[model samples]
Target: MKLKNGKMRKMMTVSLAATMALGLLAGCSGAKTPVSNQEKVLRIGVLYGGNMDDSYFRQQYTDIYEFDRKNVKIEIVPAINQSDWRYNDGSEPYKEPDYLDGMKKIMTGSNPVDVVVTDVSVLKQLIQENMLKQLDPLVQEDKFDTSDFVPAVIDGIKDLGEGSLYALTPSFSSSALFYNKKLLSDAGVEPPTDKMTWDDVFNLAKRLAKGSGKDRVYGFSFNRYMGNDPFWDMQYTYMAPLQLRMYDEKAETMTVESPQWIKAWDTISNLVKEEVIPNNNNVNYDENWTPISNDMFLSGKVAMMISESYYINEIADANTNAAKIKDYTPVDWDVVTLPTHPEKPDIGGNIYLNNTFAINTNAPNPESAWDYIKFIAGEDWAKLKSRSNSYEMVARKSYIQPRQGLSYNIGAFYNIKPVPPTNPKDDKLKQEKRGLYYVENLGRTYFQEVLDKKKSSTEALKDWSEKGNKMLQEIKLNPKTEFQEDGTPYIPEDNVSAAAGLSSKG
Candidate 1:
């Protein structure tokens, strides 16, 4: 996971890709003597989260590179930045740029890269700009089995066209309702069920928050940091599943003003008004609300919280004054699906909205890069990658089934069953909590606008529709074009250019 190690591995992959391209180009051009092995080296650009040692990101990059090296020669040049550069851009010159800045570096860097890997927000921007190479050729060549990947993940990678696929998502995170089993049992409350509605959750919240003043224990803790914090979390967890569509796919419009959205807003507002959940100010004090919520629950101060499944380990390990979580040996906490709206049974899990991989349009070795892409998304790599990260869920449906020789029992955490033996558990909680239906940042804004009471649900939806359409229009109309020093436009299919810009919207 070390940054240096990642950088080294990236260099190796990029070098190999370059080597493969040189040899391939020689034969295609009918050169008498093919290019020597020394001339072949491929460059790949990658922007990773956290440090190079970040288990999930590191394992992903390493697994793919190692797996592909045996079959193809390639080098991966990774630009690993520990700090997020986007946030630091305007405010602090000394600090790192946030996610966007980091992505731009990988996309527009001087080095010749065959593939670029990063998050959806960055990939979406590249896609809009037509910076990514269409992966249909690779798919047709049978380099990878696209059908093995989950439908939701495939949908995420495809453009509007039926055959177009631009990227691949290997893993992602989702939300779940985590509850302290002992506390719920002590209160004589039936553990939450997957079938529970928001109203049912509210009743439990009211019962859990019975004590007054200092002795009071709230039902849930949530943050409201405009777009990133509780705003998005609540939207994905509470609003979207209510069948509130933020944007109309066909019309390319926002629908924030819908009555369903209004109901969602009013429900959250009521919770705040009744003190069932902490207000925005209280929750915002902590940078990340999950830890605070975990602490509160582990300490026997809160009854339940909605959080990422990865937090289960932290909660089970945390120390608390009311009851030492560790002394209980193995913790007795359980996950439940986030409450659903009465009318929206189909709506549940959020989709993966994190880092995905795309071929750079200008990559020197497209074929070999596709090979690596296939390897990364293949069964061998998927199984190895799954064992390396606790937070990530493999996007391939085949990999989701039980696998032997894994370092940990990952299936145990994901194949969770509901408590109290009520009907078939269906493992809905695990599915929903595995990056199944994520709301975008723009979607989050609509939720915030509604929650803040600044706009009616209908009005918010209208605004979102306008903004989303405008953005999509800008992307479609402004096709990205690479140019030469002579100022002539460069078409990707006919020309090879060292300098190119990949553009797409988040």
Candidate 2:
């Protein structure tokens, strides 16, 4: 999640800005009927966020629902182990030897949760296997009015089950362009506007980039993992704006080495070699080696960046933490529209949904679980969540409004149409084949080689097209036939870059 600018002299660390791409919170009074006594204790078993007691859960419950309520006792059932929660980034790889084992235990074992929170992908898997309770009947019986929800979000959920509404989200994460107002001011350049093109952003970065040696501050940066996933990479660039997909879902064929993708790779490769954009090493350069994208911008190390809605809360947290060490003035920052592709000036950002809610097919208290899920998605939940500034927008259109205190351009968050998943098997491609990391890793190696001067950008991209084509072909053909993770079908990991015939990190 990153941007462009000019150069001249030494600069002071100023509070930078953050822009998120999602959101939720609010209060409700008129919508629902009273809860029945049988639904007093709501046991929710979250599939991924282990223990179901993370700060996000507690805060939402206590602040919004007011824990220990006279009418309801919300208990996160099926206690999870501290070390078992695993989020597979590239380095660790995606391996789930115990896929849904915990949730299964909750369903079949003595202690179980009535509700579950999991990723959209996992929910889709469950839906396909008929392991989740259908919510349409409940909605109809209660006369639950869902017209307030963002239709795309609701449609996305229904699409997971061929037209069955099996799940929904209280809020979603989004991506946007954030800029340092002071940096642009110092460069004698105007800050980014809501309609800047990619070239426009790069030029701004060049103008704001200044100094040399250790004092050198490059013009732009980004979220470190952008290039590691094909779908995400496309979303972050040209293909998404035009609604292009690498794989044709209807035909079930791979469409790689295209003009749009190739041109994007060429453009990005040149930028890296010129040092217009920082490498992975620089972007994640914290001494502690933690994931701190916001700190780089917050400390004025970079002028602009892309970030999820969650970064807004991070900005507030970092400022509060820094204030304890000494009095520190926050950097002035704001947001603009994300850069647009010249080919598709009308398009803006590629919006992706993160977390969602579903019920176990064997849920003992499905009604109560429905109540909890409905409450979270209802107007009251959105009203309360809005004030938290967590960046996740409620899935409702009316609740999607500006934060009370922030002065940035909030419209950028919703100005563009979202790039939805193009294929039903997109998630399967990402997980089963580790296709995300594979293509991402391959492209990254070749792209970075250009920056290292080991190869020309032309040479790298040509190699990329060929090797990427081969990989996409295998990925398209490989079927999720077996449940065994190790014996899965995918292009075997290679020890060298097939394009340059050099040893690779893969």
What TM-scores do the predictions have? 0.57, 0.65
List candidate 1 segments past 4 Å from native: 1-39, 47-60, 63-112, 146-148, 159-164, 195-197, 223-237, 240-262, 280-294, 318-330, 341-345, 348-351, 397-506
Compared with the true structure, what per-residue lDDT tens digits does model 2 show for residues 85-164? 35444565335333345556776666567787765655666788788899999888877778877655677678778988
The clash count for each model shown is 62, 37
What TM-score does candidate 2 get on C-alpha atoms? 0.65
The lowest-lDDT stretch of 10 consecutive residues in candidate 2 is 1-10
Predicted candidate 1 versus true structure: per-residue lDDT over 179-294, tens digit per residue: 76776777788877764677898788777765655455677654211112555445545654453555444323445666676666667766765667765443323233443343
